[model samples]
Target chain A: MAHAHESNTKRIWIVFGILSVVTIVEVILGIIKPESLMASVLGMKILNWIFIILTIVKAYYIAWSFMHLEGERGSFKWSIVLPLLILIPYLAFILLVEGNYIYDVYSESFVSWDF
Target chain B: MEATVNTQTEEENVWGGGNQPLGASYGKMMMWFFIVSDALTFSGFLVAYGFSRYKFIDSWPIADEVFTHFPFLHGVEAPMYYVALMTFILIFSSVTMVLAVDAGHQMKQKKVAWYMLFTIIGGLVFVGSQAWEWATFIRGDYGAVELRSGRILQFVDAQTGKRIALDEFAQPIEDERVVHLERNGVWYQSGEGLPSYTVNEIKAGFMANENVVGRAEKLNEDGEKIMLSREETAERLESAVHVVEGANLVRNEYGNRLFADFFFFITGFHGFHVFSGVVINVIIFFNVILGTYDRRKNYEMVEKVGLYWHFVDLVWVFVFTFFYLV
Candidate 1:
């Protein structure tokens, strides 16, 4: 029992190390503005896609490791994460696409509306 | 004697935990619900931000230029560093909270209390820093022009992301100024001219200037104000606009109407979470010192609170990416 718990402690620390590395990657990707990455990938801006993916990955580690969700039963774990997984992406897609449309509407016609 | 019950309330699972220990209670479930609601609130603000970004697709102030403050490096032009630091602070505190819970499981009272104290302090610091960030954002950055139609027209270098100021591009104020006619006529108290600077001032500078002045038109590719050609820059020197003072949603030195609104709403929502997290953490810290969880022997309370603390850090990851990175 003692050895098992010790190994868990070691594993948690490893997860922390991974999270730190991921955050560094995010910061670097944000700052560098690499043209190749900035170009379109998978139908979205590559940089934007990178930011979203890295954020979700970090959120996953926080939940599974830091919150000890990994120890939870599959049902319990999926209840929280699955709902968010389905809902958040749906929201993001709706808002992002709608936002682009609004931009189209706003830019199409120039009315001297500024007074 | 062993007790057994054949009947289980059907609604137990609906309103309460069905299989879990009763004394485990439902407070943590309630916390999850609150987090869900909070998440929705943040989404609403971010969606609004997207709406505004869509509106000013071309001329929107780039996020990178507006948020370039870092610690100990005064005016270092290090954008996104503060939010990154705030992210690390929140996550590290979460680490301490989880350690506290682990210590609690081992019944190390002193260690638990100490770790909880550190976590509480971290939450407080994050909230305070968020306030400072908000203050800097609310106070204008690059002064802008409120066009006659209420839309914002901000100056940008044609090639550089660098923002052009109204003053830099505007003609200098001269002795031969058009003092408000209302002052002499006393016939009408007209609402103030759109801004303090007169059209004549902007025109005078544009007419006299050599540097290209960008005329910010509507976001229409054709409408967008391009820099005057080298010769046109000199000819249009008299009409060049200067930076106007005061607050209007359309024209802030920082960029657009959407940026300010979203910055306040998103950060304010996040700040509120940190504030409440601190309060909850303080309560838990006091309970640890009072040995409440020690008496319970299970130490589950600390674990549940640890979940919440980590959740706050999780939300910040997305906030930082969307607001600062993407």
Candidate 2:
């Protein structure tokens, strides 16, 4: 218990620092909004890249620090987090593609459909 | 504990075969599983929101305009500030909770009590702020058109895509249509009318006023209103009451009704958690004051609640990111 307390203090500060740094990166990227990268990426915009990356980083910190997964056993940590990592990404991919597909339908094709 | 569990054996146990690793208590383990499920639930919601956003990529409501409110600063155009403050308060409470748990370990009841008090206060403040936010959202800033099909059309200036209020283009309520005879809805339920005006009434008034045009929700290539612009939107809102009939779903002023519904449900759920956390903290605070845990020689109860408090903070982190920052 003593060990846990001592380590938790150190861990909290370390996590706080990491969180602050990630936040700064997000702000910088948000403000810059550079168009060169945004121009094209396999037809996906660069802004999407920034959003995805930052979101992933935030998700990582939440799982690792907030969850205390880092302190848990390797197998235990993997069992919980890895499953989510595997699933969330897949869900994101499918949904984003499907979303773009739907958007095309609504913006372009929806008008053609009669009531 | 391990020996006892092992001795109890598989015969006596249906739960986990009486074996568990990591030394986490039953309560904590269950909390973990519950949180995992809850996290997935939130992910599904956010992902669905994203999917819908992708479907209407160009025309979906901009988040900035939808969430602009700060205390005592009516119509100042301050966006995301209130939510940002709410985020900070939650984080600060997390810090205090950890401190309380730290003091709990050291057997300092007084320190634990003080820290826990601060945490409770923080949670209360968060709930209060959320209520204010909900009120602003429900009241809606700019009234819009409700179409028969349930989509929304916002009035905007013909030139600029900026949203126009019905009042701006709409004429005053016709006394002839006033089924009322008094200032308030007294005497008979003939009704003074809806407290907030609707789009249809504005449309009726717009026929009376000149230069006001109704615009569908979609924007043109220049990111301006496709049909209505600032002047027309303003004109309709100036004289209208209630909301556009079926158009209630796509409130021009508030964006999509689904957005508001989700906002209320999501943040309301979170606020409920915060409120309950505060209540639990209060109970523990009393227990601490009464020396219950102190006498027990272990403040694990406090530590357990701290875990929950921290979890609440963690959830808010994601909520803020997706709902505001993104």
DockQ of each: 0.46, 0.40
Error in Å for residue B159 of model 1: 9.1
> What value does the lDDT take at residue B239 in candidate 2?
40
Docking class of 2: acceptable
Residue B276 of model 2, lDDT score: 83
lDDT of 1 by residue, A59-85 (tens): 888888887777665755666667767
Tens digit of lDDT per residue, candidate 1, span B160-218? 63666667766767665454675588776655445545656656655565453444533
> For residues B1-326, what per-residue lDDT tens digits would candidate 2 score against the true structure?
74565556644664755455544556666666676777677778778877776776566666666787788998787776677678767767877787787788788899999989998999888889888887777666666655444456565554554556666665555543434555765576644345345445566666665555566546565334457544655553454434642222234354455666567667777788788889999999899989999999888788677767877787777677667655
Backbone clashes in model 1 = 32
On DockQ, the candidate that comes out on top is 1
Model 2 ranges with Cα > 4 A deviation: A1-4, A7-11, A17-45, A107-115, B1-20, B159-161, B176-201, B204-215, B219-252
Fraction of native Cα contacts reproduced by each candidate: 0.48, 0.32
